[model samples]
Target: MAESRPNTEVDLNSWLPITASRKAKWWYSAFHCVTAMVGAGVLGLPLVLARLGWIPGIVAIAVAWLVTWYTVWLLIQLHESESGKRFDRFTELGQHAFGEYLGFWMVMPQQLIVQVGSDIVYMVTGGKSLQKSLALITPQADFRKTYYILMFAAIQLVLSQSPNFNSLKIVSLLAAVMSISYSFIATGASLWKGFGEHHVVHYGFRSTSTVKIVFDIFSSLGVLAFAFAGHSVALEIQATIPSSLGNPSKKPMAKGVTVAYLIVALCYFPVAISGFWAFGNLVEDDVLLSLEHPNWLISAANFMVFIHVIGSYQVFGMPIFDKIESTLVTKWHCTPGRPLRLVARSAYVVFTAFMAILLPFFGGLLGFFGGLAFASTSYIMPCAVWLKTQKPKPWSFHWILCWISMLIGITIMTLAPIGGAHEIIVSWKSYKLFQ
Candidate 1:
C-alpha cells in the first residue's frame, strides 16, 4: 500500500499544470526567473526613487535585492527539506512548516493575491504599453485605453491555453530578452536626456510636506518590494527541474537565481539612476513615459515592454490556472480537458482585464498590491517558514535574520497600502474610468 500510494500521487500530478513535467534545465530557470522578476515593477523604480531621493533610494533597492535573494534561497532549500518528500507548491511547504490546515489558510490567500494581483497589473502594463507605442507611432490615432486593454486580453485569452509552465519556455525567453532590451533603451535614453544641452534636473524629493513624504516613503517601499516578487513563485519554478538523490534541484535553481539577480541588478540600477538623473523629482510614474524624445526608441521600448508583460502574465497566471483547474477536478469532480482550460483561463483573463480597466492606476496598484500581498509572499512567508521548520537556535544568526526580515515585511505590509490608497484617491478625484 505504501508503494502504491507514491505511484498514485505521481499519476495525479502528471496531469497538473505545475508538476506536469520536470524536464527543465538550469538555463530555463535563469530566463524564467528573469521573466518573472523584471516585469512592470522595474519600470516604476525611478518613481520610487523620486519619492525616496538619491541616498535612501539607492540603499532601499540594494537592501531589497539582498533580502529577497536570501529569502528565496531559503525557499529553494525548503522545497526538498523532507527527505524523499518534495513540497512542489508553496502551500505544500507551508503545510510542512505550519501543519495542513493552518498552512493552507496562511499561504493560499496570500499566494492567490500575489498571483491574481500580478496578472491584473500585467494586464494594465500590456495595455498601457500598447497604448503608448501606438500613440507614438501615429500621434493622431486616438483610442480609449479600454480598447487597448481588451486587445491585450484577447491575446491572453489565446495564449493562456498553454498547457503548463514547461510549454512557455520560448515565450519566457523572449520576455527575458525583451526586459533587458527595454531596460537598456530606457537607460540610454535617460542618459542622453541627462547630458543634453538643455538639461534642467532637480534632485529634490518629490514632495515637501513631511506627512506626505512619510506616506510616499511607505508607498515606495511597496514599489521596491514589488520588484523582488520572483520569490513568490520560486518553489513552483524549481518544481519544473528534475531532481534525484545524486542531483538536487537546488543546485541549478541557486545558479539560475544568481544569474537572474545579476540581470536584475543590471536592469534596475541603470534605469532608476539614469531616469532620476534625467528628470529628478519631475520623473513620471513609469520611467519610460518620462523619456518622451527619440520617439522611435521610446515607442520600440514600449512595444518591448508590451511583449515582456505578455510572458510575465503567463508566468504568474500559470499557477492560478493550476489551482483553479486542480480544484475543480479534485473537489467538484469536473473532467479535465481543453474545455476546462478554455473556460477557466478565458474567464480569468477577462476578470483581470476588467479590473485593470476599471482602475488602471499603475503606480498605485503596485504600491497597494505590493504591500498587501507581495510583501507577505516575497519577504515574510519564506522567512517565517524557515524559522518554523528549521528551529534554528534562538538569537542565532539565521534566527535573528529571519526575525529581522519578517519585521521589515510586516512594516511594508502594514503601511504601504495606506500610502497606495491615498495615491489612488488622489488620482480618483478627477479620473474617469475606462477613459
Candidate 2:
C-alpha cells in the first residue's frame, strides 16, 4: 500500500499575496499607475504627432496602449498563475522568468537606464518651467538652465527620501491629478489658440519628414510607447492590492489597471490632437513651447508641468531607492532609512540632475529610452514570461500572439533607437557644456 501522507492545501495563484496589514485600497493602485505613466510624455506629444502626422500618431497611441496594456495583463496573468514563488519587483520577476544572467544584464540595466533617464527628464523639464516662469518676473536674468536644474534637484532630493512606497501614495495621487489638470489646461490652450485666436485649425497627415518616412513613423511610435511606461511598477502596485487567504482572483489589480489606462488615454489623445491643430508644422519639442506669450494659460500650464514633475519624480525614484536600500541592508550592513541611505539616494538624484545639465538633450533621450527600455520591460519580457510560465502549445493562438508581440518589440528596439540617436546628434550641435 502507498504511504499515507498529511493533506496540505496549496495556492496555485496569487503571487505577491497581500497580507491583511499590508493591503491597500484600489484607488492607490490606480493613482500609482497614473503617476508612473503620464509624465514627460504629454510635454513631448506635439513633436511626436508632427513626426507621424495626425493619422499615424493617433494610431500609434492607440496601438501602443493596446500593446502595453496587453503586456501588463500578461504580467498579471503570470503573477496569478504562479503557485509557490512570488515577484514583487521588476528585476525579481525578470530573474524568475528568464535566467539570472538575463535579469542582471539585460533587464536590470534597461530598467535602470529608463529610471535614470526619467529623473533626467524631470530635471530638464522642471528647469525649463522654472526658466520660463522666472522670465516673467526677471526678464533680464541671465542664469542658465543648469542653475534651474540644480534648484529642482534640491527639491527632488528631499522628495526622494520618503520612507517607503506607502508614504508616496498621496504625492503620487497629487501627481496624477496634476497631470489631468495640466493636460486639460494645455489642451484648452491649444484649442483656444487654434480656434479662438488663430481662427485656423490645422491638421497634419504625414506631410513633413526630415528623415525617411519609415524612420519617422517608428520613431514617433517610440514616443507613444514611452507614454505608457507604468509596466515597470505593475507588480509593485499590484502587491499593494488587498488580497486574502482565500480571495485570489486579481480582480482589484485588473480593475485598477483598466481604470488607470483609460485615464491615461483620455488625457493623451485629446492633448495630442489639439496641440497638433494649434501648431501645425511649427510645433516645438514641448507643445507648451508652441503656445504664444502674453497668455496666462501658457504660464499656468508650464508651472503645472513643473509642479507635477516634482511629485512624479518621487514615484519613479521610489522603486530605485527600494532596490538600493535592500542592497545596502542585506549586503552592506547599512541601516534602512538612515543617514547613509539618505546620502546615497540624494547623491543619485544629483547625479541625474547633473547629467541632464551636461546633456540637456531631452527629446532625443526620450525617444531612445522609449525604444530601448520601454519596449523590453513593458512588452517583450512580460510576453516571454507569460509564454514560459503558461507553457501553451506551439503555434497555438496565444503562442502566435506572443511571438508577434515579441517580434514587434524587437523591431522597435532595433529601429527606433537609430532615429533617437540621430535626433540627439542633430540637437548636440547647438548645445554647450554647463550653459
Candidate 3:
C-alpha cells in the first residue's frame, strides 16, 4: 500500500510512526538535542570568541542560547496547537500554518541544504579530529584533506546503518556523552596551553577579526548562532517523547530542552573563553587545530571528539534520509528496507564527503549556510509560524515578541551569509585548490 501523505492538521499522534515505540525519555531527549546543538558548530566557538573578545563573546553565546531556547519553545508551542493536532516534522508545521505551497517551499529545501551541508561539516571536522589523534604516533602524516577522505570511508564501514531515525536514540546518547567528555578535555587543555605552556598570545576581554571579511562582525556572530542551533531536528526529536510526558501537561520535553541547552552553555562558554585566551588573534578556525605538539591529553581529547562526530553525523543525517526515503518510496513506488534505499543513501554520503574535501574552509561555508539557511528555519519560521497560527490580537505583547524575533532572524539571515561568503572567498584565495 502507498504510504499515506502527511496531514499537518490531522492528529499526528495517531498516524506518525514515531509514537509507536516511544524511543526517547527526557534525558535521552536532552541528549539528542544537545548532540544536535553542539556538534561541528561547537568547533568554531573559540574562533568566534577570538574575534569578538571575552565579554562580547560571552554575551553573544548567552543571547544565542536564550533566543534559540525560546524559538524552540515557539516551535514546540506551534507543533502542539491547532486544537490538539500535533506535527512531528518542520515541513508539516510549515504546511499547517502557512499555505501548503509556501510552507513546503520554505521548510523542506532549507532542511535538505542543512542536512547535506552538515554532513560536509562532519566529514571535515571528524576527519580533522581523527587526523590529530593519529598524528600522536606518526607526526608526519600531515595532509589534512587525506584524513577527511579516509574518515568518510571509515564512517560507512564502522557506524551502524540505522533502520530509522528513532533507532538512533542510542547513537545520540553516546554522541552526547562523547561531546561532554571532550568539551571538558578541550576546555582544560586550552586553559593549560594558554596559562601553563605559554604557546600563544593572550587577549583577555578583547576582540579582533583575524581574517579580512565583509561583515566581519556578522560573520563571527554567525558562527555563534550556528553553535547554538539545533532547531531543525527539534520537533522530530520531540515527537519521540511519549505523548503523555510531553506538552499539554508534563512537558518533559521542556525540561529536557532546558537541561540540554544549559549543558550547552556550560560546555560552550568554557571552551570559547579558554580557547580565545589561549590563542588570541592567532586562533585557527578549529580550536583543536590550534593545539600545540606533544600534548597527549589534547590528542586523546581529539580522538574522543572525532568519535563523537561520527554519531553526530548520523543524528543529523537520519532525518534527511527519512525525508528522501519517503520521497523515493512515494514517488517511485520503491519499497522500504531494500537495496535501492541503501544505495541512494550511500550515494548521498559519498556526495557529501566529496563536497567536504572539496571545500575545507570549515568556518566559512558552514557559517554562511548556518546563518542564512538554518537561521530562518530555526529562528524566523518559528516566530512567523506562531504569529500566523496563533492568530493573536493585534499589537499585543505576544505579537511584539514575535515581530522582534522575526526582525532578529531577518538581520541574521541577511548579514551572516555575507560574512560566510566572504570567508569562502578569502579562504579560496589563500588555499591552492587540490594542493
Candidate 4:
C-alpha cells in the first residue's frame, strides 16, 4: 500500500507548510497539543458538567481523555507507517490507508471541517473574551462583540501570514502558558466562590424535562469532545520533528503527547469540577462568564483567553492554509510566494471573522461543529484508518477497541450535532446578525 512519490526537479515539500521545517523539539508538540486541546471549550466545561450532573459529566470527561489519547497515538504511529515516506497531512495518511481517491475524499472533508470550524469558533471565543474583559475593566464602556471580533481578526491577519509551523513557536508557547494560567485562575476562583457564605450552590441537573435532559447530555458530550481536539494536527505537528530509521518522529512525538495529555488532565478536571461545584446549574455557558466577582482577576483571565485563542486560531488554521495554498500552486499553477500567502491567508481570516460575527453563539457553535466534524477527525477517523490499515483480527483486542471507539465517536457524531443544531435554532429565534 506504499504509494511512490513522484520525482520532481524542485522539492515541493519545502514549499508546503507542514514540511517546511524539521528542527522542532519534543516540547513543541507538548505545548502545541496543549494550545490545541485546552481552548475556548474548557471555559464551557462547567456548563457541560451542569447539564449532565456530577457523575455522568465527570465520567464523560475521563472517558473522552482516554479514548482520544489512544486514537491520537494510533495516528502518530501511522504517520510513518510506510517505509521512507512520511504522511504529513491527514489526507495523505488517509490516502495511504484507503486508496488515493477514497481516502482523500473521506479524510479531507472531515479534516477541513474541523480546521475551518475550529477557526470560526476561535474567532467567536477571542472576540467574546475580549469584549468581556473590556467590559470588566471599563464597566461603563459598552461596545459590540462584533467590534472586538474585528479587532481580534486584525491580529490574526498579521499572525496568519507566518510562513510555517516553526514561525508559530512563540505564539504557541504563550498560548500554552495562558491556557494553564487561566485554568488555574478559573479553578481557584471557583473554589473561592464555592466557599463564600453568601452564595448557595445546588448540584443538580440543569434540565428537568427528560427529553431536554437527554438532548443536553448529548450536547454536553459534543462540548467535551470539543475540549479534547488536537488530533487534526497530530501528523502535521509530527512532520516538524526530524525523523530517520534509527530515530523515528513517534518517539519524540509520543513523549510530547504524553506530557500534553497530562497538562490536559490538570487543566480540565479542576476547572470543570470546581466551576460546576461553585455555580451548579446556574453556570454560564463559559465558566469565566460565571465567575464575575473579583473584577481584576476575572478581567485578566478573559484577556488571557483572548490571547490564548489568538494562537489557537492559527494552530487550527495553518493546515487549512497549507491545503488552500498547495492546491492553488499545484492545481492552478499559481506561484508559491509571499503574494500567494498574503492573499490566501488574509481571505481565510476574513471569512472566519465574518462567520463569527454572524453567529457568535459560542456554546451552540461548539456543540454543532464538535459533533459534526471534530468527533470525526479527532475521534472516529483515526480509528477508522487504523482498522482499515492494520486489519486487526476480528474481535481481537485492537479490533474490539477500534470498534468500541468508533461506536462512541459515531454516537457523538450523530447525536451531538443534532443537539447542537437544536441549540443553534433556539438561539437564532431571538438573534440578529452583526449586532
Please give each candidate's TM-score. Answer: 0.97, 0.89, 0.89, 0.97
Off-target runs (Cα >4 Å) in candidate 1 are 1-8
Model 2 residue 219 CA deviation (Å) reads: 3.1
* Model 3 lDDT per residue over 289-338, tens place: 88864468778878887777777788677677667766665677565454
User: What does candidate 4's lDDT look like per residue over 1-435, in tens digits?
Assistant: 222232352456787677889899999999999999998889989898899888888899999999999999999999996575889999999999889999999999898888898999999999989999989889776888899999999999999989899889899999999999999999999999999998787877887888888878778878988998899999999999999988999999999999999999999999999999999998998899988889999999999999999999988988998899778777887777788888999999999999999999999988988899888987788999989988999999889888888999999999999888888888999997788
TM-score, prediction 3: 0.89
> Number of clashes in every candidate structure?
0, 0, 1, 0
Task: For candidate 3, give the lDDT of residue 249.
Answer: 20
Residue pairs in candidate 3 whose N, alpha carbon or C atoms collide under 3 angstroms? 53-206
- What would you estimate as the lDDT of candidate 4? 0.90
Off by over 4 Å in 2: 1-21, 136-142, 197-215, 395-397
Residues 1-435 of candidate 2 have per-residue lDDT tens digits of 222221221211121122112366777878888888877887778778887777777787777788888888887655544463446667777777677887667568877777777778788988888777666656786688899888889898888766667677788888888888888987888887877754654454343454555666556656766787887777766766655536653677778788999998888988888888888756777787777554566677777788888877887787677667556555675543347556878888978888889878767777777887878878788887878667889999879878888887888888778777777887889888888
Ranked candidates, highest TM-score first: 1, 4, 3, 2
